[model samples]
Target: MIRQPFKARTPEELISLLSAVAMAILAAIIVMVLYYGREIIIPIALAVLLSFVLAPLVRLVQRLRIPRSLAVVSVVVIAFAFIFAMGSLLATQLAQLAGDLPRYQSTISEKIQSFRETTAGRGTLERASSMLKDLSKELDKPKEAANSLGTIAAPKAASPKPVPVEVLQPDPGALESLQTLISPLLHPLATTGIIVIFVIFILLQREDLRNRLIRLAGSDDLQRTTAALDDAASRLSRLFLIQLLLNGSFGIIIGMGLWLIGVPSAILWGILAAVLRFVPYIGAVIAAAFPLALAVAVDPTWTMLLWTIALFVVVEPVVGHVLEPMVYGHSTGLSPVAVVASATFWTALWGPIGLVLATPLTVCLVVLGRHVERLEFLDVMFGDRPALSPPEIFYQRMLAGDPTEASAKAEEFLKERSLGSYYDEVALRGLQLAQADAERGALAPDRLTKIRDAVQEFANNISEQDERPSPKVNPTTDVEATSAIEGVAEDAPYESLRVLRKEDLPSEWQGDHPVLCLAGRNPIDEAAAIMLAQLTDAHGLSSRVEAAGALSTANIFRLETAGVAIACLVYMDASSPAHMRYSVRRLRRKLPKATIILGCWMKDIDPAALESLREGAKADLAAATLGGALKLCIEATGVDSLGTGAEGQISKITAAS
Candidate 1:
């Protein structure tokens, strides 16, 4: 019998099917986000998330047998205290900076006017806002008339649009005065409330929350959900805590620099350095530019301005690249492309608060994916490096290292099915060349270094270019940067952030420059300050626990003195060629730091690492409570006897009571 003619899917049907799936998913996500946009939304989301990050901490504390309530309180308290102290420090600086607003403004205005006069195309003693306003309205008469008629029925609300942009200015005492008077009242109360409420709620209902989760999910679902929550919370707590520590380092370095330079609000600048660090590429530039502008406004010498720039060159990368990525690695698993896209998407959708929540939200997505399976697609999309078996990886590593055996073993280790056309060609070419060279005895150590270095240079070129804005697109799908991702770079001169520049510079900066000092509620500055101090002290560790329980704060060279103090931050990256050379070039500045002695040991950390650590800490603290986790970090880093046995106490209580 003849078979009936078969019909295939038409192009339209295929398109329609795909389109409907996409739209349905989009609509559902938007509806969910909107439905729970406020109130329990942040908490519920944070609870599920923070739990995963803090799971490790909870496990640690459970080992101590301390009451869960007490453990959480301990973690919360430590986190809050660190944050509060930082806030206060930044507030003091911001107040100081604002207090000097008049001076800062006057100087900036003068500089603007001078530039405007010098360049015919630039400006004419006019503020940017006023200039833009005039230009916008110059040809808008007809449009204005039309707009007004359209709105004639009533009127649009005239509230000031919130814009966080504020120009840098010189201030003699405005910030100090404001801090002395106003901040003491407002800052403490608001900060205190956030701390108290967050801590109490997390501690009190934690068990109930866990039980509710268990009830909502069936056995398998319950186990998976609990595991997911525990993992995310523990990791997140550690990440957040690490972030705080890193940021604090940045603030210290920056503040010291400003202070030594006789800049009025060193503390403020330091804090700015720390908080701005959260914004990635953009933040570092802003932080660097601010202090440089201040230095230029006050100092008559071009040398000092150059010094400021030079210092930034070092500071930005040291904290941004070297320090951050160290402990964190690519652990967040988010690709650079995914990170920037998510940040931009969330910022557009929910503003600054959303920007702060973007990474955490992404983390939540990854965790959720582990449970639902469907969402795991996102985890793969966002991750920097694909996960593989360790033993298989080690075998591949050995194979590649041999060069002679690399060709035949390519698919044997990498997998035949997984290779894309592009990847297949590239791998074959590379391995073939290596194998041939091995046969010819061209695999000398020198040649290996040369090829490796060339690869690195090519990669660095890629990374620098990757910073450009991406093509605009809907936020529904993954947006990745490159197929071959680069390793994190080296950190620069956070030490100079703590350096004293006035003494290092000509007499003009000391006497003739108009010092503009102001302050505001920016936490990044505090971190910069801490970092600056750490750099100068010769020993790079910042945590009290790391420094044998003594708060090591000496010589953390502020900006003024950092040029001479800090030598370099070194690192190693095997994942990408761009990682090594770019980092070395960025951190070392071609001129090496003088070795004062033979006994000094220095280690470099990637700045990305700090944020990861902070996120981990915060998530852990929120989910599992903090006592055990904090103790673990302290003990891990070898902090003085804060009493490690407490973990056992906490764990015993969980089981017995």
Candidate 2:
């Protein structure tokens, strides 16, 4: 066997390979900087977040006729003072907690014994222990038997016993002792100092920093850069502020709950929880561990521990699910997976501090991606919004031959839109994409067949839905006044044909199948015709669908045209007007007196081209959407047949035309 050497078939392939390699290299470099330079970056990140939290306060103080420098100083001083007070209180509580642990030793021992007694019976643990004992006895029997049988070895000369030795240095003087005591604190003090300095400068020179960022990002697109910055700042500020308040509230509630439950050092646990909750996902669990362990040690019975567990289980969910969503609205805009992945990545690089800052940092990246075209992949990966639009998703699902998911998507869309609009906006557009791909020869025959089958199945699944189009008031129209009317407002956009009832259809259209929907030449054309027939049936006009082959010169005369009042030739790809004209002529010959309407379901079709096609086909009317076709059919029935209620609507449709 021989392997062929790799070669680029086109410049595009080579460029793509090079671009991917460059991106990988860039990512590796970024990771290295994040890991090695975290000490510097961490402080800056903290300072930036702190600045966001305090910006509103600084502005508020400045608004009260104070100097900007004074306002900033005042806000920063006040904020740090509160944080310092909390820190001192936490330290005191922690010291007390440590001092009290020895008192609970007896209770802890009793609980452990009780737990062991309860689980000592024939379970997995007990069986494993018994087996280990038997194995140990079996091994020892060999040594004992050898000794009993007097299987002795020759004695060797006695070895000398080694003496123990110890080495000690002189005791340190006071200066050395003081240096030793303070050495461990130096790093933390230095880090704190850096953070404070950064925060002060960031707040004082906020505008300067923003301008520098904009310049670094790009001065050419100032508007976009400014918008991105504003979006990021506002989002981060709102997130930080709300998180602070919610976490603080959570702590206060936990403290009160623990106090009521008689847990030791409740206040300490509460403050610890509030601080740790800033870290994502597992923070609450870590915070709960301290109090739960204390509960176990402090109480003889399991009541305290159970109560503490219950407190966390109940409170965390309520705050996380109910309160947080209500307060944050759309949240930090990072996807759940992005949040977890970022937490792991940043923690690996910078430890606990990175974990706490992960969400805020990822938000910045997502915002940047949203604004910068080159970095848009970041937003698509990390942002909470769906990456693909409805039409693209539908097309993808169709190609994958998953009609179930495609139908699900359609059902969701139909919740807010009428079936006609959904077909026009999503299904038809998806088929258009498939048609385009097929025309370009990019799709394999099998893939095209799968798409066609999936689309047919999806259309069939949703055909039973009620077709009375949902009345949608135009944005410019007064919704209140429109709602006050008995039926759909005349000024509202006509989504589909409206009939008072099935009985209200004209005598000519009263038969079991009054509308004939004929597919055009394309493979997907039958799917479009099916959609039109479904919509037509929904509006009280009974409809039947026929495949493109039914319109052939040989098969045309055999199509059932009896009692058919309207005939619509449906085309997914309407690029060739001559083919559409030929199909229209065949349908006209079959149903000579029937109203012939050309249904060209092309998105954004040029008006002149459509009119020319209609004229060339000699179609009574042409529609560029499923909704328009249904409307044209309804109009052909005449306003008198639909009763007085539909007169105004038909008149408006005519005036618009």
Candidate 3:
């Protein structure tokens, strides 16, 4: 037997595949360009980040009637001046610290000597030393014999230096000496000059540059381009400003803490800390290293080193975890993994400079993903937003046969939503999925059983998990709630639905006012029926769920005698009204006086088909959601109040009447 080659049958599928391949190639090309062009790119990126930081200052200066160019120049000059001064101060402190290193040499020597003495006996060091000494003595015996033998062997004529040879050396010129001094500074000076020039020009022409970028990225769609650029600018500017303030605060705290701990050059350490922290992840460690090393060198004991370590360990976490979340919220829109991965990737591409620019660059990518259809994958992969909605997640859990997680997800949703809403949004949607799978012949028998059992268990425990009272609905002229149930099953289902046993009517569900919830063909539909019954019971209407088998021709007489005031026929996965119309008509005929409700439980229903269903089935009521159907059931029973103690009141009214 030969196997036929697989092929994409649809044009859309083929196009999608090609697009994915193209995106992969594009991403590779981008990584390569960023790596190779880093020399120029790094400075430009630095300048861009700096512009975000200094734009507000430039605006402030301009507000004072200063020309834009002059404002840009003034801010740049002041910033560079402060930076150079700080560098010079740090150099001076470093030189002094270096000079003081000699004083700690004695302390270091004493500690080394103590360690040696402490490990001298009965240890790996002692054994290693003993072995080395023995080996040396054995080697020295042969060397001594060789020396003795050489001395006995001889006399020879002395060699003499026959002639003097001239060797000329050229002296260094003044220019050459100057060149040597300046060559080390040349590249750095040139780069700094370029950065300053870029910063000044960017600040002066900020709006023009923004407009140019919009044209370059989205010339055909000006509105989208403008929105994307504005969003990116707003987010980047806010992130940079907040980070600067937070880092500055961190540095100030370190300085004060060090001062209280009696460490030298606390101010210098603080300044270094603030600047270095622009680099994420490892920045805090790098900033702490200098202060820790200085503490070790300046103090005669280890107390200062320990205290300095403790300070950073405490401060970094507090700022990173608590302060950042409280202030930034979801403004950055980056996942923690995305943050670290971007840092590593940028660091690899542009070295330390890339690390410094990673967050801003990643933010730009997220914004692009938000606006560009093709690049939406980046947002799904890296942005902090949830990839799957609650209904999708619940349905996926059910498909995977993880009842525990499905129930847990239901409970989580219940925290913010009502149990009825949960039924409509999560439980019913999951059943729709199962029904779809059963239709496609994709769901396994056992897996279907698991999904059914899980959903039923969740419905059964709604009251136990949520202690809140059920919502009140009026008995007459049932008001339709406007809460939209928004989920559709886009994927095929994987399993069959669970079957539910017909629940016995409660004692109070007697006389002429009991509610009957009719389960459809599948067990998943029965789960929905269970929820409706639960709601009816909560609404002061006594209710019971009955399987379809219990209401067949043979049992129609039994149901008629049961004194059920309302019959709610639940169809969670209604493919069409044609198949259900006969069953509904039969139920309607069997209970002529009872109010019949045909509930097509889904996110959406066709209005024409729904009207047809109502006409064909002769259902007195029709609903598209569990909540709607349950509301109709409660209304049909003529229960006015859903108060917690209404059962007792209802019993007393019945007795009085």
Candidate 4:
């Protein structure tokens, strides 16, 4: 027998496979380029970030009537001059600290001796040390015994010990001494020079560079390209500026606190804190280490050390958690995990500088992902925004059999929206998706059953919540709310819906089981009916839900319809309007006096076709959304307080009938 080759089932599958392979290869190539070219790229990346920080300052100078060239030159020089002064001050502080370290040696020794005494006084350490000594003695006993035996057995003359030889080279002259002194400085100095040159050129030619980037990215879509660039620039600039301000303020506070706490070189520690904190997560820890060490050395009593520890513990959290968020306001657009992961990745590729630049670079990637068509996965992966919409999330949770999370999501959405709106916009749409999958034969029976159970569970969880918007809140009348309900038939206009209070509803609708929500065919339809029933019950009208089987010929006669004022037939799959018409006819026969409304959750049906469906089914009205069906039920209650638009729509439909 011969084996057949595997193949993609569709063009889309084949294309997706090829595209994924291409992306993986592209990613590998990019990583290689980044790693191999870091010597050249690192300096340029630093310069670019620096330019973003300094661009505003240059613009400010230009606003003062300075020429562009002069402004660029002045800003670059001033910025670097300030950096140089800070470096010099840091060096001076370091030299002084080093010189003063010898004075603390006695205190350090005393501390060490005290620690040793404390540990020795504790029996645990002493026991471990004594055990090691005994073990060594036992192990050496055999060797010593052998040596004694050899000596007693008239061992040969002791072998002469070889003398040790040492080799030395001549001392270095002035050139070599200078080379030795400057070798460590050469890389940093060269990098600084390259960065300075790059920054100056970038600031001078910023517009030209932006144009080139736009052309390279997408000249045909100038709007998108410009927007992407503008977004990236604005975000990067804001992030850098806010971070600088916040970190600087933090450092100042830390310095003052450390000084009051009697820590040595508080100013130096503060500067280090401000500078090092540009590296995310671990920067504050590194910055605190120096001051903590000095605190321990400067004060033998441990008071200063404890104070320094407390200072960082309290101050860093306040700055990072409180101040940064308040100031940043989603400026970075990077998730916390993305920030850390990008830091690790870039640090691997470009070392420490990459750690500092990770967030800004990832921000550019996110902005590009948001604006560019092909790179959207980057935003989905790294951006702080939710990757999936509410309906998709709800559907996915149902698929995962997580009713709790689905209910939680519904509750969260309900905080700002009525439960009816949530059902129309989120839950019903999610069920529609399930219906689509089921129609496509993609959903297994057991999986469908799980989804049904999950939906039912979710409905039960939030059933008690009021369906009306809070009195203090103004209800949303946005077109989006209506359009979400209408699904794909956006051209069909919908009337504004309002859930009426129980007292506001007519006397007939105030009775028990005024509305009967019957599932059209499947469990998905049943789930949708459950939503409608919840909505109707939440509003003033009493409602009950029955399965599709309950509406079968055998069970139809058994269903109690004495108090049912309205019968809402729900069909998640409305492709076969014949079946819906049949169901509607059956319900009409059972409840001849009750108003019949068809709730078609289908996405593709148009208004004309829906009206045709309603008329052919011999139903009084039809709606594509839960909200619409609920509104129809409310209007059926003979309430006149509905908005004029709603009343007009009801009148038009009634007259047409």
Q: Please tell me which model should have the higher TM-score, number 2 or number 4.
A: 2
Residue 552 CA displacement from its true place in model 3, Å: 8.5
> Which candidate number has the best TM-score?
2
Error of 1 at 303 (Å): 4.4
Ranking by TM-score: 2, 4, 3, 1
Scanning candidate 4 in windows of ten residues, the lowest lDDT window is 648-657
The digit string of per-residue lDDT tens for model 4 on 1-657 reads: 999998647989889999999989999999999999998889898898899899888989999999999999999999999889988888898888889999999998999889888888577878898899999999999999999998899968989999999999998999999999999999989999999999999999988998887776765778768876887777777778778888889889998999899777778998989887877788899899999988878898888888889999999988888777787663367788998899899888888778777877887789778876667899999999999888889999999999898877777766665566677778877887899899999998889878878888887888755433243332233334222123232222223444455676666676778899998888888888888887666555788999877878788789988778898888887577778777777787888888888877787577777777777777777888776776667667777424333322211110000
- Residue 123 error for model 3, in Å? 7.0
| Stretches of model 2 off by over 4 angstroms after superposition | 1-7, 137-168, 219-221, 466-497, 500-503, 639-657
Better of 2 and 3 by TM-score: 2
Candidate 3, residue 249: how far the Cα is off, in Å: 2.2
TM-score of 1: 0.44
Error of 1 at 548 (Å): 73
Task: List the global CA lDDT of all models.
Answer: 0.45, 0.78, 0.71, 0.78
Which residue pairs of candidate 3 clash? 437-493, 443-494, 448-495, 448-496, 498-523
Q: Runs in model 4 with CA error above 4 Å?
A: 1-14, 119-123, 141-173, 464-469, 473-511, 549-555, 604-609, 639-657
Q: Candidate 2 clashing pairs?
A: none
Candidate RMSDs in Å, in order, are: 30.0, 5.5, 7.3, 6.0
TM-score comparison, 1 vs 2, better candidate: 2
lDDT: the better of candidates 2 and 3: 2
What is candidate 4's local distance difference test score? 0.78
